[model samples]
Target chain A: MSLSEFELIQRYFAEASTDASVALGIGDDCAVLSVPTGQQLAVSIDSLVQGTHFLEGTPADLLASRLFGSALSDLAAMGATPAWLTLALTLPEPDEDWLQLFSSRLAQLCNEYHVSLVGGDTTKGPLTLSAQVHGFLPRDHRLTRAGAKVGDLICVSGCLGDSRGGLDGLLNGFENHTEAGYLLERFYAPTPRIELGKILLGKANSCIDISDGLLSDLSHILKASGGLGARLQLEAVPISSQLIATFGEESARQWALTGGEDFELCFTLPPNYLALLSQLPVPVAVIGKVTDRADIELFLRGEPCQIQGSGYDHFQRKDD
Target chain B: MSLSEFELIQRYFAEASTDASVALGIGDDCAVLSVPTGQQLAVSIDSLVQGTHFLEGTPADLLASRLFGSALSDLAAMGATPAWLTLALTLPEPDEDWLQLFSSRLAQLCNEYHVSLVGGDTTKGPLTLSAQVHGFLPRDHRLTRAGAKVGDLICVSGCLGDSRGGLDGLLNGFENHTEAGYLLERFYAPTPRIELGKILLGKANSCIDISDGLLSDLSHILKASGGLGARLQLEAVPISSQLIATFGEESARQWALTGGEDFELCFTLPPNYLALLSQLPVPVAVIGKVTDRADIELFLRGEPCQIQGSGYDHFQRKDD
Candidate 1:
């Protein structure tokens, strides 16, 4: 018998949930979950369409990773502990092989993050996946983009521009190169810094995930923090060896500034907490400092530098 | 300036939440909400794609209502009180007029249901709307499809055939007929029986929302309930006057049996509680009884009748 929607859910999607907080999982009109007392539930939704978000040749496993990872990154940005997620998947047709790979990878990711796939929907259409991720944080402890102060030290976890390099490599037919492979992996499976986000909860004054390039995403924090700006030391912005070796320093620096989908945490902390950051498990770099001015400034080798373009704008054509 | 995704959200979606449980609303990486103590959160997701779930010329306002209304019906089926919702909308282009009408209607519906639009994502792609709705119910009081007993009485709220009649009218160029208007409205914007669901909690043995026709959706309840079946009295199944007026008795009866998108609650309750159903605000019809046999039986004029099909199956071709 061909797999019906109900059968698809029962066989592939309705795995037993490991989360104690999930009172009920798949196979119901709604999944029931428990939120512990003194905690607030954090909810975020993201949709990724075939050509708009990922290329046509992307693997099913990688597509699953990219979609869920990007969605979970929002929970990371909020400093919430990932708990449960629901996926609404639309497809041109049902392919059992593709479904198996997608569901397995998604389940693996959920297992690693201790999140349960509580509920979702499946429909026939052009390829699109929308995930709604839920997490929880102690009341009043969430890190918001509006909390940055003028004197805060701007910090970022891990190197930036790697995912952009990966995307460029894929577009330019450079995926066979060893360096390109690493970049492609970064682009296809960007890791959400959930642990770092939880650690930065009270210490970081403001935070955002670098999805739309550092400049654009940081601008969100700046705008939300009452018109505060930032001053960046170009030399301090971390770039991966693969990116620099493939495209050289100048191009790598440009990608680091404007290439989107890094999925790294960009946060601001008081100068007093700089020493505490040393105790963090992940390598963090102080890229800049928050400024009272209302626009970002860049300095390369102590000389003011002009940067072209901010970040990806969905509605604006590239040539515009 | 062109309408950027951020600008579009700010202009239309960033509304103040009426729900006090919403600790944080739009314009953040995540929306934070509080679930009342002693309650479990109920989560469900639904997606509507162009040409599949809806027609090309469907009004934006009606589309919004249908999408959210159907999603909310899942919560109603679970007997959960609606609390928060997130919408992920993918559009071909930014149409300000369309967006405004869609958002306003969605907001109005949320207001009527006291649900908060907490967070969402807006992307550019072929038109698709996915909504994830969250609700809450006391931990032990949830109504599930698995709870039906063989001896329980089967009941349904509101008329069943109207939406199907409406769909037929839309497809057959009969939409302009005055008699078809009510059916069209029913198809375009079927109201979720939330109040009735809430009233049925603790009283109903099992419940499910009618979306994919009476038989197909009830089959879900039966399958979930484990080896249970139902005996539906064809004569007693509720049919609207509009449906009978548009199409004669036989066609109307068939539509009532197999046409989908009703968004009405079909529930089973113990025989003793049948009288209590009279207190419900909406019309409740006793259509049948739960059966010990493992397959649904239909009787017309107390004579066994053969039915051709049950309901819409996403993967199955119409001809099959």
Candidate 2:
């Protein structure tokens, strides 16, 4: 059935939000929300295009999962509580099956993340989805990229670059069933470190998400922190065993250091806050230290190392 | 030179904001903002595609102005104060000239509206732009579509159908110099009725923006207000003299009734609140009245009349 914009929204996106913070949701020209008193609002917007961000025939459910997973990761990096999201989706035409799967997965994710889908606009064009997320943070507290100081310890949560390995395996085909399944799952449903981000809110000096690889994302933190530098012990970077077994340790380590789309948290802590690291709900590794020097130095097993590529750039990809 | 996303944002979008509500602008995982206490937050997102929304080879500056003007009209409809915006822009390639024009016009509009360009994401794809705007409203007050009662007077701010006339002139070419210029200007740069909306905040019973022709948009307000109907006096519908001279009386009336993209405000007020209409800064026409009937009735000079088209729908345009 060819659905009008109003009918489409009424059918799929008119789920009433029970959250008290949402004074108004879908159906209005603008969504009205209540940001709790004594809290600042944090917002982030990201877009995913058909060919640029995903394969052409990627399943609608997996695409929704990955899109929202990556977008919400920004909120996770900020130590903010994800509260609401607005989606602007463009499609070449209305496909019932695709809309069903996409909206269902998106609704599921919103429920899982405790965020209400507040508003959306659907248009006709090439397949592209943009999501703007709104969240809340304590007014006095901030977890930013500019706070990492010299002598601070740099850390990352969970495994890095498994999503990259998954992409590679999906492209080249994997030999091991168990490893391929694990890698693909990670790629399709990468978790954002929201809890860990909140835990580090007051303690972590600076924070960023590992979307553009550990090296590149960490460089952003360093650069934002007044041209500071970092010394990363390559051996300390976390790599999943599945990724290492599927693609050898060398390839896995390279991906962990430079592959993009992991959605894990990379943050800095003052040496005194080391105790909080052990109390984290998720596994974390101290991979480096912030330095006064002006360049990022890499060490593998205590020996200086060099890598071939940096993180992905939208306009100028390293591989391109 | 091909620019990375970070460099593009830093060069074009990193204007320092004097707005105190913006706690942090570009150069971070997310934009941090402070919504004043005792106020509710209002958010709206809109997407414009190259082929669907505007003609190919449209000037970058004009395109930017039109996109923002149409999007901010949502905030105006809600009677909210526009405060911040996040842009997710996708481009096939980085064209310095296009970027300069687009970003410059965008900056000008942000300054004009007192809204900050807080954060943005630049990606590689077919040209598509999505903007999410955040604004603020008094917690206890609202001007919504669902509150219009049967006896309310329906009024509209500014002339209608001039943008449609402009579009027609653009496509078919116009003869009158002054009228053509006025219509083309209207088509290219729509002014969102923000100040008028704020004035209507608690006083007006219900309000909506005229994006998709008067008939279509007012129908939305009527439908949302529990299926109430309206009686529109066709002669009273405001049509600019320029549009009438250019398109003739019948065609101009039809366009005034159904043309989209005008970005004016259509609101309803109880009869007791009619005095506020004359006091409005902009010229307003009381074109209709809400009624208990379930169907819209049109009359011209006290005689029943019929119009050809209703309004614009994104998925199924009437002209299409």
Q: Report the number of the highest-DockQ candidate.
A: 1
Clashing pairs in 2: none
* Residue-level lDDT tens digits of model 1 in A227-259: 999999989999999888887787789889888
lDDT of 1 at B70: 92
The most accurate candidate by TM-score is 1
What are the lDDT scores of the predictions, listed in order? 0.85, 0.86
Clashing pairs in 1: none
List residue ranges in candidate 1 displaced over 4 A: A1-3, A6-16, B1-18
In angstroms, give how far residue B294 of model 1 lies from its true place: 0.3
Docking class for model 2 is: medium
Q: C-alpha displacement of A95 in model 2, angstroms? A: 2.0
